[model samples]
Target: METFSIHPIGYVRERDGSKVLEVLPEYRPALDKLDEWGHVVSVWWFSGSDNPDTRSILRQTRPHQSSPGEAGTFATRSPRRPNPLGLTVAKIDRVDVEQGLVVIDRHDALPDTPLLDIKPYSPGSDRVEAPILPEWAAHWPKSREESAVFDWAKEDGKA
Candidate 1:
């Protein structure tokens, strides 16, 4: 197999209870005009889950109560896959291109997580008007705003 290299262009940070993506000085230029977008797709590394055992996991049994009984790692957003990469669409709260900082509404990645890349969330390409979903997750929130107040614990079988 061919190997490739990946590097962090920034790190996720938490300041005053807000999630922030602090781009490294060298990568600051990349943030130019990023603030024009209302939302961005953040690609980050699941550093905590990166291990031989986790990487070897190919399947998960009932990873989520609202998910299928069993699913391949790829089918579900399991961090324990061949590559522990995380992708999230976060609403932009603020962006300081000069300071190389992007304050986002929310993200699932932990503080200090390595940020790989950021892409503008273009509705033209990213949105699906009538995407199909599995029966189990059909009841989930339809948008990120709704998800913010959603009863996620119930989906995890914790509530």
Candidate 2:
């Protein structure tokens, strides 16, 4: 198998440290004009799951309690998939270009999550007027704003 290398441009600091995307000093210049947009699509790596065993996991039993049962890695957003990569569209609250810090709304990623890339969210292309989802998840919040009060733990079978 061919191997590839990926270097993170920054890290996601949350909770105790600071809920922000701290761009490395060398990558600070890349944050220019990021504040112009209200949101950004962040590509991050699930570093904690970066292991052979986790990557080899191809199926999981009901990642979501609302789900019917077992699902293939691609069927569910399980961190134990072949690639422990995370993609989220985060709401940009503030951007400090000088300090290379970007404050975003709640994200599933943990503190120190390796940031792969950041792209400005364009509603014209990113938003789908009619998206098809499984029956279990069809009742999810229609927009990110509506998700603020959602009980996520309940959906994950944690509550």
Candidate 3:
């Protein structure tokens, strides 16, 4: 077996202010020019996951927040898996060099998520064709224009 090691460039400070991550010192150098970008893609490890005693008996149902469905850990975004890794794209709301951290507008990741890698979300550099998704997954629930309408209706309660 081969062993590997990694360090974090920076950590994600959630908008709510209840969560924080201490990025590894070794990888701190990578943050030199990171904050200039408006948004970034974060690849992290679910370090705080409540790992199940038996991997074979992991849950296959979706959380209460989503529609009921059965899926393997790989099929759904379940953290309790062989490798508890997660990826999220978040807007860079603020950066604090002195504090050694950056704030993201939105993050579903739990506290203590080990920051693995960070990449700028530049359209010219990261753009790609639509990814192949599972049949059950819906590609972007609404369009940008439709989202505006939905947002307005949600606030007005006129939907």
Candidate 4:
């Protein structure tokens, strides 16, 4: 097996007054030019799910009951996987270089989550005009604004 090394550049400080990505003092200068972008794609570790059992799970029944049948780890976005990683595109509310903070409008990552990388979100490369999706998830929110009000529990067959 091949081995690799990775380190976190920062941590998500969710309870320190407000949720924000706080870069390490040494890496603070790295956030020098990230303000021009309206949004950022954050890559972070799913530390909560990084364990032997979760990493060993290669297949399982779908979490959302609405989605039928079993699925391989790669086919689903479940936290339990060989590598517990999370990617989220968050709206950049503000960037304080002095504080090494990048305040985002929203992020699902928990407090102290390790940030792997941050990239400016580019619509040209990230957006798809017409993409295909499973029939069960075809009715999902079309935009972030819509997602705020979308009934997730209902879609997941919990309601």
* CA RMSD per model (angstroms): 1.4, 1.8, 6.3, 1.8
Clashes of 1: 0
Off by over 4 Å in 4: 15-17, 155-159
Q: Model 3, range 1-159, lDDT digits (tens) per residue?
A: 576776655555554664443455666566677779888778887777646542343565653233345556666566667667788777777656556566766565776666878778877766556656444444333333344334332322112
Candidate 1 residue-wise lDDT, 31-143, digit = tens: 99998899999999999999999999999888788676788988888788999999999999999998999999999999999999999999999999888888888988888
**Model 2 C-alpha RMSD to native:** 1.8
For residues 19-123, write the lDDT of model 4, one tens digit per residue. 698888888888888999999988999999999999999986765666767768787778889989998888888899888899988787898899999889999
Q: Is candidate 3 or candidate 4 better by TM-score?
A: 4
Q: Largest lDDT belongs to which candidate?
A: 1
Full candidate order by TM-score, most accurate first: 1, 4, 2, 3
Alpha-carbon error at 148 in model 1, in Å? 1.0
**TM-score of each prediction:** 0.95, 0.91, 0.64, 0.91
What are the clashing pairs of model 1? none
- lDDT values, one for every candidate: 0.91, 0.87, 0.60, 0.84
The positional error of residue 96 in candidate 4, measured at the CA in angstroms, is 0.9
TM-score of 1: 0.95
- Least well predicted 10-residue stretch by lDDT in candidate 4: 150-159
Candidate 1: 10-residue stretch with minimal lDDT? 150-159
Model 3 weakest lDDT span, ten residues long: 150-159
